[model samples]
Target: MDDSIKPNEDIGACIPRLRRYARALLGVRGEADDLVQDTLERAWRKLHLWRRDTELRPWLFSIMHNIFIDQRRRAPEETVSLDEHALEFPVAPAQERMMEMVDLESALRMLPAEQREVILLVGLEQLAYKDVAVALGIPVGTVMSRLSRGRERLRELMEGRQRVVALKVVK
Candidate 1:
């Protein structure tokens, strides 16, 4: 047994963020949970090596992040379903709002990995810029750039839909 992992210690603190980041990165709830489980298992196995002074949540997140990247490289053409329970926003009372949310999810799925990670980390997870920089092992400027580019891409997709709707309205 690894000295670093205390059997009763709660590693659960990191699970929600891990699941959220994984879902955003993989664009599928089921696969994301599987990835999170893999991360926890690996973390548990290698627990003895973990530095006591370091924060465990970020360590787990970094592990999950690397796993997501590696999986993408190994499986280039995989299509993840975004309909998982975690990714599903509440059922909106208004149908139009629900459709818009669906469109937003679709746009998120279309983003490149770098852009998606940045947006998920900074925008969704609300991590500090410094923390995200450290976790991503990238400069803070890169995070800003990816978030900007991702938001622009999302805007373009949404605007394209709006334009089509407007055209139909005029006709």
Candidate 2:
């Protein structure tokens, strides 16, 4: 019975980033969308609980991480299909960049969940290490450790993949 009459307007600015994180976390557009919606809904309801002086982004992400784990526990593990949309590209001019992104996504998927969450929050979302810890409910040291290990594994994964060079011939 204590929702905020006026929530921070800036909260909306984080939606795009939240959507990106959710998509990366869940790997399915529909499921990711649902997760984002659930996070927002929970944040809205718990607006009163948020301290005005603290950052909102991490709080929202924390809610999302918690929801993801809870849902994961209640349901049996299912093989997450490689999101087809991540593979789609406009044309060849940017195909190289698109392919690189696909490789990155593939590598990310291979990481342990904790490490992946840390890497995504820290590297992709650009959240500070402390902020990432807050979101994942881990210590900053743990966040650093995970990030370090995740980056190393990703580098190893990417290095193992045969690099493709798309050459454009100009006559």
Candidate 3:
């Protein structure tokens, strides 16, 4: 068995878990799959450096997470137009609610990458503190701190949204 092929196979086996992690990170299923594919591409490119005995899943996840962060950093902030004709325009009441979920997911995307990453790892991915620390290349204490800060930021963002709604009601 070629040594390089073994690592590629191991990474291939971890794709499902990586996709799940990416889904939690990006919220959009398609975007998550794209992130997973990008991670696999990066992993395959760096196969020679991968240690045989080290865990592959976390390394793959870390790659995915970093790629997400880099992409977010590089993306331009464009204002979304609210043209009615442009919107898909869901009619069903339940569908409207689903659209709101998508809006919430978009808001989540706006969060700081470190906070978002921490929330996805601990809250969504259900990884242990130690594992998350190892994957993030940070101390377990740092993981806890990031999680706390991330939750607080999320709460503040939600509260601000509520205030806007309340103001509109008062008007």
Candidate 4:
């Protein structure tokens, strides 16, 4: 098999996951698709820069992460507000579980961008800590710290200790 073809195949396998992560990051199907498309384009263009010894999955993720950051910097207004749209989920067998899922989704959205990124990359995408570090261009220790804090904040939000308030009440 040609060595060049292997990377393309590997990247193809990661597309679904990349799209999932993008959707979670951007919170819109169209925006996520655009991010995925840009990521793939950049990855293909920079294929020669990839090291054979390094894992391809993390590299692709790194590309997507950088692209997301760049897009955010370029167009801050493009961010979608989670409160503007209702989160739709498939019918669940139990109402309690569905409510919990809804709460979790809301909590996830409330997290800070850094914490959210770490949580999504490590928890949702199932990337290793070191791989997440590389993808985010941060230290592994920072990744661990962010993940810990993010999980704690998520727990607090879900437990209703830190309620998501739209407006403050005043006397």
* TM-scores vs. true structure, each candidate: 0.82, 0.83, 0.68, 0.84
Q: Please identify which of the two predictions, 2 or 4, would achieve the higher TM-score against the true structure.
A: 4
Compared with the true structure, what per-residue lDDT tens digits does model 3 show for residues 1-171? 455657766777888778776765655566667888888899999877766666676677777767877786788463333431233334646976875655555656678767788888888777888878877888999999999988888877767776887999995
Worst 10 residues of 3 by lDDT: 80-89
Which segments of model 4 are wrong by more than 4 Å?
1-5, 77-88, 161-171
Model 4 C-alpha lDDT per residue in residues 65-131, reported as the tens digit of each score? 8988887788876455664365444688999888777777767778887899999998998999999
Best by TM-score: 4
Once superposed on the true structure, which residue ranges of model 1 sit more than 4 Å away at CA? 1-10, 78-89
Tell me the whole-model lDDT of each prediction, alpha carbons only: 0.78, 0.82, 0.73, 0.84
Error of 2 at 164 (Å): 12
Candidate 2 segments whose C-alpha is farther than 4 A from its true place: 1-8, 82-92, 163-171
Tens digit per residue, CA lDDT, model 1, 1-171: 557665336567677778877876776767778999999998888777667676666567667777778888898886655464356545899998988987887788888878888888888888887777766778999988888999999899988888998999995
The lDDT of model 4 is 0.84
lDDT of 3: 0.73
lDDT tens per residue, model 2, 1-171: 325624556667878889999988767788888999999999989988887777889999999999988997888575756665554334556878877778887888888888889989988899999999989998999999998999999998887775422222322
